[model samples]
Target: MKKPLIFVYFFLLISPVFAQMEFGFDDKDAFSPHSIRQVRRADVMYNNTVWVRMDLREKQNEPFFAANSEITKIIIDAVKAGVLRPYKNDSLITRMSIQEFNDNIKIPGADEGLTDEDLAMGFGDSDFGGGDDWGGGDWGSEGGAEEDAGPDEFFPNNIYILELKEHRMFDRKRSRMYYDIQSIKLIIPGELYPTGINKELATFSYKELVSNVFVDNPAAVWYNAKNTAENKNLADAFELRQFTGKIVKYSNPKDNVIDDIYKGNLKLGLAKSQEYEHRLLEYESDLWSN
Candidate 1:
């Protein structure tokens, strides 16, 4: 009886191990809370470390097919470098022809033999030469011109500004302090390329890059620090892009006026009212106009 009890106890302990190895134990199958399975991803890289990425599905098959092309990769690389001159296919052809235009006309510096109209077409302007409404007005400074200014100066610099549309706040309490994120348009400057390319042919807008809807409950951590610890300290601490909560207008937790709208300061109320009015006008004209 003692021998039988001993054998039964050994079997109970080892049976699960054998079953797991041979029959397989999947979380989906076993309905286990803590089971993990290998997930197949769209892209995989394992050079110094493993990296996996999932491809976003496009609404249309044409876009989906286009997304996976060499041209797309070339365009994406150009975009990442911030050197990509945005142009329509026809405009791009004309701009590239600039080199040819100069060469054909025997102009020493010409990239393409193109007319003034051709150059103007590429630059999205009706006329050629300077004073082409290069966006710099009496109020704003022109692009590419050397100007001594601080980092935050409005002068067109290497980085382009995307003017965000004023967002509306319907809820009276929320409106007083917080405003919703509205449309963001890319403010591409004229001086990006001195050679001048088609400005109307905007490469891609900021809104196009980032969707209108915010991602809900995205996986915060790429790699788990606890999992690294479990791996006998062989793994390094995971580097994560810490996302401070969504952009909120009134984030001050200590301020009582920020929360209480009725007793809120008059100045802030007046400012908010002005902002809300401006936003309402934009909504009516830019967003809701047929």
Candidate 2:
């Protein structure tokens, strides 16, 4: 009697599956369209590549070590100590800091040997161009010309401001010419989360797994190139202003402006950079969309 009961239980268990197959409920044609394999957006999954353009003239110069360029010895030391990592490809590398980046960066008062006169603005070789960075002007004068600038204008005061897209703006209200970061291709790392059953079981696996598993796979650079024999990384590339950035790849390589193809393209600057990066990345992602 127990054997007969066991047989009945087995028959009941397999009957529905057999019935479903015979009735074509599990037919290949009945599969949802959503179940069909779809192509993946590699960038969405692996956000390891970046093309960045830093404007060294946009942000305020660090009062400590960076004046003309942010790539100073202190920053370089930090890179060497693994507080920072510069990348050229997938490899997080330590390249020799170019001598000019180390020696030529003009920190206001960091160097003991630099004389006040040496740092002072003298009318010496206006042989190239005459005047302060803004234009010919008295350095400490209270007023120059009080004119309201358009939304995109550099400065309201100072009758003459460099209007070139590449020029740095003078914030006359603050009496300061804040520095800008230059452009580069930086491969910033992605966020890490726990995997498998550990997601609920472990409290600290994500951070620990990332630190250990990706110790060799840290954020790095992508397409920053060094045509010169002098080895340089993303930091060095931006310090030297090595890259010319644009919203989209120029259809014509000879065209100096990226606006040729991307009509009405906004000029590049340090401000609104995150907005620009996001919108551009979206443009790239849209190509993969149905």
Candidate 3:
């Protein structure tokens, strides 16, 4: 009886180690209480991490892009309000300062060639360049000051794309699969840049967004077109998968996105993305088969 009691105590002490080994997760990777369907790592039979790109301009995703209450607007406002912290990337490990976030969203070269004193002296005025016949060379034209008069800032509406990093895992204990979202990233479309380079504004932890930012914030809403009264919280909308997104990347040893794998061939990349989707469905179906 004494030997059996000692063995039981020893097993209890080592159980956590076994759990870590089974899932390759440390305590830091434990599921958050706010997670939709909190499944223990040990219960995850299979896991696939995928990156999805959501185009808010899409008809199916318009609810999230509603005029004033755009999801991007809400997030940006929250960050500005100091209520939400942004991350450097989807890893969610490094925190981004508010200044850094602001810098990233600004239209590149928009503020170039203009100083505070220049604006105060009315050097930016259109009339200053036209009426003045001092040198007759158009000072603004020589200095390219006219280009600086373009839009100096980017609005939330300009951010029409969002990227999500998530893990789709089959929880054998629950006999179901779960979409465990990790992070949400705001993307500045390539068209917005002169060089056609898409810029990542910042990444927000999905757990933090769901549990704190969107959960109780009245401003963060999913606009309901049919009935204004039926508008739901952004958190609920995400859980319901109301937005449609394209799968861009899945777990790969080389960590290449579909476009890269397909060598920038849009059609092939799209087809491969669909294939991955079908594979997920087939995997779930096969789980119940003999």
Winner by lDDT: 3
Q: Candidate 3, after superposition: displacement of residue 214 in Å?
A: 0.5
Candidate 2 lDDT by residue in tens digits, 68-160: 112222223222232332323211133323222222222223434446674454312111122422223221221111122222211211111
Residue-level lDDT tens digits of model 3 in 132-199: 22112221212111122124556888999999998888888668778889899999999988889899
Q: Candidate 2's error at 174, in angstroms?
A: 51
| Of candidates 3 and 1, the better by TM-score | 3
Ranking, TM-score, top scorer first: 3, 2, 1
Off by over 4 Å in 1: 1-159, 173-176, 192-290
Tell me the lDDT of model 3 at 34. 31
lDDT of 1 by residue, 1-290 (tens): 69999999999999867755754534444322111211112111110110111121212112211222212232232222233333222111222222221122121234245567866555222111233222121211211122222221222222232222222222221122223222222333445546553132122322222321111102111222335333211001011111111111232344332215535666665465456445545654543343
Candidate 3 off by > 4 Å: 1-37, 113-151, 288-290
lDDT values of the candidates?
A: 0.28, 0.28, 0.77
